[model samples]
Structure formats: C-alpha cells, structure tokens
Target: MLNRVIEQFRLKVSSIDEVEDSHSSTVYKCNLSNGENVFLKIPFTKLKYQRELEAYEILKGSVPIPEMIDYWSGDEECPGAFLLSELKGNSLSTKAKPTIAFQVGVLQAKMHSIRPPAEKALSGIKNEFPNWSHFVEEQFYSFAEDVRDILDEHLYNKAIETFKRMKQELPSAVGPSFVHMDFRPANIIVDEEKVSGVIDFESVRFGSTEIDFTKLYRDFLSYDDSLYIAYQEGYNSIRPLIDLENVLPFYRFTDAFNSIGWCKRRGIENNALFLKENVVRLKKWLL
Candidate 1:
C-alpha cells in the first residue's frame, strides 16, 4: 500500500501513521521523504467520498482549507482516497476564550453568507421538501425506532409531542444558503490566533443557516453563556442576526437526536448517554 502511494507521488515513504477513524472516513498521516507531511483521507462510503471531492472542487478559493494534493478514485484493488497538504495548526479547544469563539463565529457567518455556485452547490443527496415546515417535521421524526428504545420512555414520548407541536411553529424560511452543517472547533484549524484552515466538507450543503449553528450551540456555547453572546455579536457584525427564538430549539433537537443515533451505532455507551442528556436539555430549551 505504501509503495503504491509513494510510487504515485514519486517520493520515498518515511512513515505512514493512522490518525483517526471519523464517522465519514479513516484518516492517515503520511510523511514523505522530502519532509512534507500530508493527510490521506479514505472515506468509509463512496457517497461521502464523492461529496468531499465535489465540495473541495467547488469551495476552492472561497474559504480557507487544506490544499488538495491529489484525489484518487480507487479501483477494485484500492479504495478511494484524498491526499491533502496538512494544515499546520491545532483544533481550537472548547475551553478557548470567548474571543476565540467569537472569531470562529465570524468565519462561520462569512461561510453561511456565501452564495454557493449553482453548478457546484448540490454536493449531496437532493433533500427536497415542499416547504421548510415539512423539512422540520421530517427531521423532528428522524429518531429511528431502534434508537428510541435507547432513551427513557418518558423522555422519548415528550420529545415526540414537543416536536409534533413545534413543527408548525417554526419561523418563516430565510431561504437556502451555504451551510457548513458540521461547523465546530474540531473541523476548524487555528494557527496561533488566526484560523488557518477548515476541514471536512462532506456535510456541506445548501440549507438554512440556522441549522449550521446547531452544533456550535450544542458543543461550545452550551458550556459558556458568554461564548454564545460573543458568537452572536460576531455573526451580527456581518449579517443581521435572525430571531432564532422559535427555530433554534428545532435544530438543536435534531442535532442531539442525530448524534444520539450515531453514538448508539458506534456502541459508545458514555457518549450516547451524554447525547441523551442533550436531548433533555434541548427539550427544556423548546419551552
């Protein structure tokens, strides 16, 4: 495997180390003979690979991201992979100061404000619904039956009722925009104080910008109220802040709901419990 990759690049292989297996892909850190460290992303599924490739092509020059070295469409002998220049930085910590979160929030706002090129926008499965209400309603019911068994019956039933009631209560549609879908510190690379690059475009799509904030609020802002204030302040600086009173809870619930299923599938007991707790937290916010 190493020899094939090295020969393709006409470079000697110094080392190849597994980084981490994320939900979408298995990542590897490869050091070339010339002292360059590159990342190799082998997607777990073909659809994810296609989305990541298309996203990189479309998002080129529009945002900060790792430079694409090469993309390989694996045949029967090899699995598809992406070779990219490593972003020289570290992911921001959840404990980062409010100011840092504010900066990230600004970048996120800028991303959401971009009008994706029409030809390159639909990178994933077309999720067409008649209206935003229907979309929210579908997401509200996305909790699979098997996953529901993992939750306390009371909590699960309450969640259903709340969602059923709120489906008709969402704010008016603000129209489709470029959404990072998974924007968070983990996907953001920070070099010292400035953001050097953002990674992971498999989830990029056209959607409500409010949906993009779901993870940001759950992972970061929920820990510190000040971060929420700073993020809102930063975002409002670029675009007018939407009145998220009615819609925020919906997206928050969906994020928690989806995360719960993901953890359950991976057999992460503790993480599943944490996400279940978040479901409760979101339920409270729904009021």
Candidate 2:
C-alpha cells in the first residue's frame, strides 16, 4: 500500500531518510530525484493514518500546511494512508534562537480565519460544527472513562468537580473558527524571521480562537512572562484577539483538562500532575 501510494505522485525517491518520531507516527524525509523533498508519515494505526491524510487535504491553501502529494488505503480508496508533503523549513522547536513564538502568534491568527469545510468535505477533521457546552460535557465524560487508567480515583474526581464548577455561564460564540487545537511552536516552522510552514493538523478542529491563542502561554510561555508578553504584542500587532480576563483563562482551563487525557493515553504521568496543579490555578480565574 505504501509503495502504491507513492506511485501516485511524481516523486523520484533515491534515498528515504527518517526525520522525526512520536508515539503515533514515524516520519521519513524522502529525497526525490526531481529535487522536490517530501515528508512520508506512516502511523501506527490505520485510524490515525487515515486521519492524517484527511487533515492534510482539508487544510491546504488555508495555512502554510503542506499539500498532500499522495494517499493510499488498504480497503478504502486510500488505504494504510501514506502522506507526502513538500519538505518545508525547520520546525519551530529546532530553530528558536531568534524567537519563533512571535511568528507562531501571527500564523495561528491567520489559521483562525479559515472557515470549516462543508459537511461533505469534512472527511478527516472531526466535529465540524460545535456546541461549546456540549464539547465541555463530552470532555468531562472522556476523562471519566479514562480516569482509572490516567490517575488515581481521588485526583480524577477532583478534576471532575473542578470542571463541573467552571463549566457554567459559558460564553457565547464569536463565530466558529478553524483552529488547530495543538498550535504550539513545535507544530510551526520558521525561515529566518518569518514562518514558512505550519505542520501537524491531526488535532485540527473548528472552535473559538481561544483554542489557538492558548497555545502561546500553555506550551512555551508557561514559565516565561516576558515571552508571553512579547508573543501577545507580536500577534495583536497583526490582528487583535487579546482579552486578559476571559479568553486567556478559557484557554488555560481547556488545556489543563485536556492534558490529563492526553497524558493518560501516552502514559505520561508528569502531565497528570501538571493538569492537577493547573486545576488549582484555574480556580482563581473562574468568576
């Protein structure tokens, strides 16, 4: 299936180079004979493998996300999906010396401008249309199912109680935006001082701009107030979406709750502790 999909694209591959690895996928940088480079993602599961292909297709032209060169499936039209994307610049994580967080702010603001695809085109992205309260409720239940697996009984129940308290008086929508749920520095790429590419859309969903904005403080700026201030200045310089009171806290709580589940799936216990601490921190933010 992998070879068959590569055949769909006009790539000339003489050497396949392994580039990056995560819990989900193993990526290879394929040096083509045509001088065009592509990233080949082979995921561990068919479900995620297919989702990656779907995410790549829907997100094209919306951001600097790479275009899908080819996709293959075993039973479906594209099986065991193999994605080929033009090799873009260095990821933000690998090149943060000159400050990529500012670029991340601007890039994400642009991504927030994209509208969700039509029902038919939402092949890979999950939950195109959203209800904010229901989304929170679902998160509560998802955490419940994974409670025993992720943490002790006491901490899990405490999180549930915290979520229950904070979820009331939900804010009205400011129009749904195309948001990459994990819009962190690592998922963005930089060339010199500008952002050349935006990668990894698997956590892509249609939601409030807060979903994207929170990545600034939650991921890289957690311990650095100066970086957070600089990032906010850079982003709002391009487009305004700052609210120290409401949206900022919203993003924090969202990440705090979601991280617990994310940590459980990967068996990363440190995240569970982090989430519990943030739950305490988020207490003051709630009105």
Candidate 3:
C-alpha cells in the first residue's frame, strides 16, 4: 500500500518516516529517491480529509501555505490522503518573539481580506452568516453543550447569560470574512523572523474576524499583554482595528469552555485541569 502511494507520485521512496501522529490524522515525511521530501496527511475521517483538500485548492497561490502535490480520496479498501510540498521551517512557537506574534497577526489580516467562494465555501463550526452576534450566540450554545457536565451548573448558566448580554451590545452588522477559525502558533510556519507559511486548513472558513482574533487573544497574546499590543499594531496596519474589548469576553468564554470539553474527551488530565483553572479568568471578564 505504501509503495502504491509512492508510485502514484512517480517517485521511488527511499524512506518514509512518521512525523506527527494525532488523534484525527497521521503525517509522514516521505523522502524520495531524488532526496526531495514531501509531507503526506492521512486523516481518519473523510470530511476532514476533503476539507483540507478543498482548502488547499482554494488558497493555493493566494495564502502562504504548503503547495499540494497530489491527493487520493480513499475507497472502502484504502484511506484517503493528500501529499504536500514540505514547508521549509519550524512552527512559530520555536522563537516566540513578540515580532513573530505580530507577523502572525499580519498573516491573519491578509486571510481575512480574501473573499471566499459563494457556493461550497467553508462555513463556521455551527454555520456561517453575516451577522456576528448570531454567530456568537450559536457558539455560546454549542460550547454550553460541550462543557455542561464538567462545569458547575450555576457558573455555567451565568456564563450563558453574560454571552446573551454581550450579543445584544455588539454591532448590528459585521462583514463575513475569511478566518482561519483555528489560528494558533502551532499552525503558523516561520523561518527566523519571516512567516514562511500557515498550515492545518481543516478549520478554514468564513466568519466574523473576531472569531480568529479571539482565538489569538485566548491562546497566544494573553500570555504577554505586550504581544497583544504588538499583534494589534501589525493587524491594524493592514485593516481597521476591531473593538476587541466588546467582543473578547464573549469569545473567551466559549473558547475556554470548548477547551475543557476537548481535553476531557481526549482524557488529558493536565490539560483539562489547566483549562479548568481558567474558568476564573472567564468569570472575572464577565461578572
């Protein structure tokens, strides 16, 4: 089976080493007879496989992502997979400089400016829409479902009510823009101070820019307020600045709650505990 995949690419495989093994997918670094290497991603589910494939096609030449080499949609006998030209750098987290974080924000701004296709465009986790408040409401409910069992009933209800209030206060209309939806340092590829590419497009979609911004804030920028400021400086240089204060708390609650559920489902005790500890941070922003 492995030989067949290599043959399809018209290359004799010298060596194939497994690189990243995760719950949903496995990646391999395939060394060719010519010493060139490519990355293969084999996803456990078809939807995820197709999503990544389509994302690569849509963003090709437009976004700074790895180039797709070839793809095979699996049948009953074989699993689906895609091959990509291996990006030439480590993840952005390797350096963790404020300037790199700022560049990450700059890349995100470029993605947000791109107009997604009208039909067959990827939607948000719930569904994409023009109204940002409705999107926030959907995320609030979806997140509530994920973490209800693990959270204190009273605190959980309070969080929902807080989201409802914030929803009302948000601007009536927000343009539906392309957002990575899962933007994080791990998904950003960098060479020294330059952003070489961004990766992991399975969660790519069109939605409120705030969705991407919120993930950035909760995951990366919060660690250093200066990074947050630096990020905004880069982002606002390209596009109009968002009122993150008005939107941050609402998304923060949903993201933190969703993380708890993800950690619990994966049974990662330390991560779950770490996420649970942030519930206080959520409440402080709300109440």
Worst lDDT window (10 residues) for model 3?
121-130
Stretches of model 1 off by over 4 angstroms after superposition: 1-11, 76-79, 119-131, 268-287
Find the 10 residues in a row with the least total lDDT in model 2: 278-287
Worst 10 residues of 1 by lDDT: 121-130
lDDT value, residue 73 of candidate 1 = 77
lDDT (C-alpha) at residue 76 in model 3: 74
Per-residue lDDT tens digits for candidate 1, residues 1-287, read 54565566565668898875355677778887889899888776677777788778766786788998888877665567788999888886777777877787777777767664665446353433225566655655565554586667777777677666766677666646667777877788877767776898776666677677777776777798887888788888888768766677777766666666666666766565666686676556544
lDDT of 1 at 139: 52
Which number leads on TM-score? 1
lDDT of candidate 1 at residue 85, scale 0 to 100? 95
Cα shift from native, residue 263, model 1 (Å)? 1.9
TM-score of each candidate? 0.85, 0.75, 0.83
Say which prediction, candidate 1 or candidate 3, comes out ahead on TM-score.
Answer: 1
In model 1, which residue pairs have backbone atoms overlapping below 3 Å? none
Candidate 2, residues 185-211, lDDT tens digits: the string is 666667676678777655567766655
lDDT of 3 by residue, 71-119 (tens): 9887775567888898887866633788987787778777777666766
